[model samples]
Target: MSGLVLIEPTELYNILNQNTIYPCLSDTNFLLLLDARNKLEYDESHVITAKRARCDGEENFAIPYDAELECKTHVIIYDGNCRSLREKCRALQCANRMATDGSKNPVKILRGGYEDFSAMYPFLRTQKIIYLPQELDAISTYPCEILPSILYIGSKEQATSKAIHKDLKVQAHLNLTKSDDVFFDSAESEKYLQIAIDDDREADFGSHISKIINFIAKNREKLRTILVWSDQGISRSAAACIAYLMSYYKWPLKDAWRHVKSCKHTVRPNRGLVMQLSQYEESRLGSKVTNVDDPYY
Candidate 1:
C-alpha cells in the first residue's frame, strides 16, 4: 500500500481496456503512464499513449509537459524488462522521481515492465503517441475484465469479435440470451454455453445458477479467460457473473454484487434475478445473507 506498487500485466490491461469499467484512458487526465526506457526503444513502440520519461539512470527524471502529476489518480511506469522494484531499475528510478514530485498514491511499476505488458496485451501496444479525445472515444471496445485473466462480461457483439477472441484468447463463452442465438464457431478449443432466458424478472433462471458456476469453475484451469454475455450485457449476463462469484468465493450476495458492480458500473441484474441470488445465498450457505428489499442497490 506504500512505496512502489507492482502491478501485473493483466491488471494493467484491464484498466487500459476501452470497454471495461473505467472510461477510455484518453478520456481522463487522471492517469499518467511513463516509459522509462531509452529514447530509441521508446520510439520503436511502447504501451499505448505512454509518454517518454527522461531518466539519467541515477537520480534525475524529466517528465514530459510538466504534467500536473499531483492531479493524476493513477501513475504507472515501465521500462524494457525490469522485473523487481527492489532493484535500482530504470522503472524504479522513474517511479521514485514521480513519488518525490507528488503522486498521491504509490507510483505503480508495471511487473515485468514493457516486455510483459506488451506481450500480454498486444492489441493495446501502439506506435502512435498523440491522441485526441474523440479519436480514443471512437476506438473499438473490449469486454469488461471482471477477474483479470479469468473472467470477462461483455455485449454479444464483443463476444463475437474475432479480434477480442484472439487477443484475450477467451476459451469459454457463456451466452445468457435466447437458446437459438448461437454466435461462435467454438474453434481453437473454445467452449460455449447458452442460458436461454429472457431478461424478465419472472424468468426461471434459478435452475441454471448451479450449472453456470459449474461450467466456469470446471473449465477455469483449461481456459485463458471466460466471457459471459447477454445481448446487451447489463442484465442477465451480469447476474451470471454475480452467481459465479458467490458460489466460487462463498461470498454473500451483497458482497458479490458489490464486487461485480464495482468492476463494471453498467452491471444491473433484474429484480427477479436478484431475488434468486438472494435465495441462493440461503440455500447454498444455509443462511440469509442479503437484504433483497434494501434500497442500496
Candidate 2:
C-alpha cells in the first residue's frame, strides 16, 4: 500500500493539461499514461496521450521504447473499473510492475479506472494513439475538479462553454466575476448564482460565504455538480471554493486551502480573501491558526 498510489481522474486531468515540473525529458516522455485494458477495448477509446501496457513472453511488463521509466516524472496506469489495488486486475498488475521500476514518483493507478474517468470527463476520451508536443500544449482547458463530480472551479470562459457543461454534467453555475453578463441562459435560471466582485483586496467574500456554501450543499444533496468560476479561475472563485470547503467539511483554513490547491494548481486567493478565510476559520475554531501574511500562502 505504501508503494502504490491511487490518483483520481481529475488529478490526472490537471496533470495532463499542464507542463511537467522540472522534467529530464519532454512532457510526452516525462509523463507516462498507461492503459492496462486489453487491446480491443483500448483501440475503441482511451484517455488521450495514454499508451497501451504490454507484457512480454516472460510475463514481465514491456517498457515502451524511448519512455524512460526511471526519469519519467509520472507513470499512471488504468483499466476498466479498477477501484482497488487489491484486485488481481490488469491495472494492479501493470501498476505493480512500474512502481518497482525505480520511477521518479510513485506509479499512480487511476482510481475507478476508465469507466469512472470517461464517465466524469468524457471530453478527454480519444482514439488518437500519439500526440505531438504542440498538440499536447494546445489541449483544451476546462474547469478544475475540486471534489470529483461534486464541485469544480474554473474561468469565465469555461463557465460559458456549453460543451463543458454537457460533458462534465455541470448542473449549477456560481459566478465570482465582475461581469454584468449572465453565464447561464433563461432555461437554466434555477441553476445559476452570482457574486459580483473585483479581484482587489477590498472585495469582501465574508458577507456571501454563507450563501455560497449553502448553495453548494443544496446542490450536492440533489447529487448535482456545481461549477464555480471567476475572471481567471485563479483568485476569487478559488477563495469562494475554499470557503465552501471550510464550512461543509469543518476543516481549518489551512487544510481547506491545501485541498483546493491540490485539485487545481493555479488556485491562489488574493490577500484579502485569505484574511477573510483566516477570520472565518477563527470564528469556527475559536482561534486563528493560519498566518494571512505568510509568504507560504
Candidate 3:
C-alpha cells in the first residue's frame, strides 16, 4: 500500500470523508481519538492526550503493541516538528511495511502530526474496540445422542477434540501451548489423542485440508456429525478452507456455516470473510438421525 501524507486536519478529514467504510470517522465524530506522543506534551495541554504504546522493541511479537487499542482503524498522530518525529515515523513505517507485506489489515498513519491537528479537531474518547462475550442459552442435561465417530482437524489457534471421544464427553483444546508453556507438563492433554499445531508456525492449508478429507472419508459411517471451530470466527483462512472443502462434499453452505457458528465450545473462526460450505444431502450410512438440524450449513 502506498503511504498517505496529510498536511492538515482538514486533509485527513477530507480523506476520511470519502472513505465512509473506514473506522476513523466515528472516533472523530465522538471525540475519542488519541494522539501517540509524549506524556509531557499531553500533560502540558497537547491537542490530544497521548496514549502510550507498549514498547517491547521486538519487531515481531505475536501480538502487536496497539493490539489492545479498541478501535478497528487507528490514526497515529505525533508532532512532525518534534525530534521524536523520526523515531515515530520509523516505527509507523515498520508497522505499515508488515501490513502490506503480509495478508493482514493495513495500519494508517496521520501525516500532519499531533501538534498541527490535535487542537484543530475535537476528539472522541468513548468509542473503543469492544467484543461481547458469548453466553450459551440452551442447556443439554444429557448429551444429545449423536454420531459416535469424529475426525480431528488441527490448526494453530484452536484445539478441537476428536469426534469419537467428544461424544463420549472428551475435550480437546489449543492456543494454551504459547511460548510461556513450552516446558510445562502436557501429560493430561496427551492422555487423549491430541494433536497440537504450532500457532507461530505457518502450514499449507491445502495439504492439511486434504488430510482432513481423507480422514473423514475413512470413518464416514462411524462419525455422526462434524464440528468445526477456530480462533477469529471467519478470520482463520485454513479453517475456512477446510469448511469449503467439506461443503464441496455435499454439505449445505448455510448449514455448515451455522453448525460452526453455533458451537459454543468451538472457537468461532473469522467472521470477516464469507465461507459457504456445502451440506451433506443424505445422512451418513450407519448413523441414525438424532436431530433434524442439518449437519452442514
RMSD vs true structure, all candidates: 3.4, 3.2, 19.9
Candidate 1: residue 289 Cα off by (Å): 3.2
Off by more than 4 A, model 3: 1-7, 14-34, 43-50, 56-77, 80-106, 122-297
Better structure of 1 and 2 per TM-score:
2
Query: Residue-wise lDDT of candidate 1 within 1-297, one digit each (tens)?
Result: 236888887667656654544356755655798999988998899988788998665548877676777777779999988888678788888888888877878889998989988876788887887878877766676787788788998887777788888888887888888744344543523367777899998998899998898878877867558999988788899899999999889899998998777666667888998889888999989998788899765
Q: Could you arrange the candidates by TM-score from highest to lowest?
A: 2, 1, 3
Give the alpha carbon lDDT tens digit for every residue of 1-297 in model 3.
434332334434323322112222333322123334444554544432234332335532222344343333434434333233245453364344434433123344455555445444333111223312221111111111112223222222223323323433323222212222221135633222112333332432323444444433443444423322233323343354334444344444445444443321233332222221111222222332223343321
Question: Tens digits of per-residue lDDT for model 2 on 1-297?
Answer: 227788887888877654223212235455788998888999999998889998866556777777778877778999998888677788888888777766667889998999998987788899999767666666667677888788988887778888888888888888888674354743564677788889988998898898888878888898988999998888999998988888888898889999988877768888888888898999888998777677967
Provide the lowest-lDDT 10-residue window in model 2.
17-26
**How close is every model to the real structure, measured as TM-score?**
0.84, 0.88, 0.25
Residue pairs clashing in model 1 are none
In terms of lDDT, which candidate is stronger, 1 or 3? 1
Q: What's the true lDDT of residue 52 in model 3? A: 36
Cα-based lDDT for every prediction: 0.80, 0.81, 0.33
